[model samples]
Structure formats: C-alpha cells, structure tokens
Target: MDDSVRALRAQYGGTLPGPVEALPAPHRRDLAAVLDQARSRQQRELQESTDASLAALPKPLRALIRKALGL
Candidate 1:
C-alpha cells in the first residue's frame, strides 16, 4: 500500500474495512485527510486536557510528578 493508504489504515487504528479499501485513490486520499484531521484534533484535545490536569496539581508536586512519569 502507498503512504496515503497506509496512513489511512493507521489513522483508522489499523486494518481498514473492505469498503474503505475498495475506494478509489482520490476518495481514499480524501478519507485519509479527514481521518488525519480528526486524529490531530483528538491529540490536541488530549494534550490540553493533560496540561490542565497537571496544572491542577500543587506546584511543588507538579515537577516531581512530571519527572516521575517522564512527562
């Protein structure tokens, strides 16, 4: 599979369905773009949540937590 298809599969969390695999290159690329956008948004949201969670911790403990967790 080409990069676009591989990326699409990866974004889909692996092993794309048969229907998706059967789509034409252009449509697959479009789907891949959509999935990429969704993944990016999810990652951004997760990072924001993590930062907020960390910020809620006591300042003195925050550094120790980050170091212990390798964040």
Candidate 2:
C-alpha cells in the first residue's frame, strides 16, 4: 500500500472502519459496480441542480460546479 494509505490506517488505530477484505472477490466486484452507479447518479443530480441554477449563479460558479462534478 502507499504511504498515505498506511498512515491513514494508523491514524484510525491500525484498523479499518469496516471489514474491507472480508467480502469475496465476486461480492467485492458487485459492491464496486454499485458504488460506481451511485457516484454516476450523484454526478447527474449535481449537474441537474447546476442547470436549474444557470441564470441564478455567476458564470464562474456554474463552471466550477460543472468541473467539480466532472460533467
């Protein structure tokens, strides 16, 4: 693991918040796919919110939100 990740583990008293590796590989892949879908949905929602505020926000702030959402 990278130093930063190791340091983070140590920061949390050398234990993970959850049993990260307890799940089998197939279950892990399914979990990753679900997380990806949720993240995509979140990005879409953020974009819709920014779109609804197009005229209310300054051009810079709207652009910043779009960039932050990776949209």
Candidate 3:
C-alpha cells in the first residue's frame, strides 16, 4: 500500500473499503478528494444525528447534558 493508504487505514482502523493505490495519478487524486468529502459528510451526519437525538430529551436535561459534555 502507498503511505497515504497506510495512513488512512491506520487512522480509520482499517475500515476504508477500496484500493486507492492502483488508480492512475489523476484518478487517485480524484478518489482521495471524494474520500475526504465522504469523511466530512459522515462526520456532519453523525453530529446531526447526535443533536437530533439530544433534542428528543427534556430541554432542561438536554441543556445540563450539553453543559456537562461541553457540547
């Protein structure tokens, strides 16, 4: 694997699901960009999901939890 792929696998606990190294240089760059975007979207979705779930709680309790968690 290339250093980039190895680094990604290490950072993400080996869950990255494709062979990024075998592509041509331009395609590799495009794929890397796509992967970066996917990671960003996944993070945003997770944060939104957490916020939505927390919103289901009582307001006062949610406020307290948020304060305690420094959210």
Report the C-alpha lDDT of model 3 over 1-71, residue by residue, as the tens digit: 56566655555676565565555556655566677789889999989998998999998899888888788
- Off by more than 4 A, model 3: 1-19
- Candidate 1 on 13-71: residue-level lDDT in tens? 88989998989888999988987888889999988998899999999999898898788
Ranking of all predicted structures according to lDDT, beginning with the best and ending with the worst? 1, 3, 2
Best by TM-score: 1
* Model 2 misplacement above 4 A: 1-18, 55-71
TM agreement with the true structure for every prediction: 0.77, 0.52, 0.62
Every model: Cα RMSD to truth: 2.0, 7.6, 3.9
In model 1, where do residues sit more than 4 Å from their true spots?
A: 1-3
The digit string of per-residue lDDT tens for model 2 on 1-71 reads 44433443544456644564455556555655675677779999987876887758787787787677776
Error of 2 at 9 (Å): 13
- Candidate 2 shows a clash count of 0
Q: What is the C-alpha lDDT of each candidate?
A: 0.87, 0.62, 0.73
How big is the RMSD of model 2?
7.6
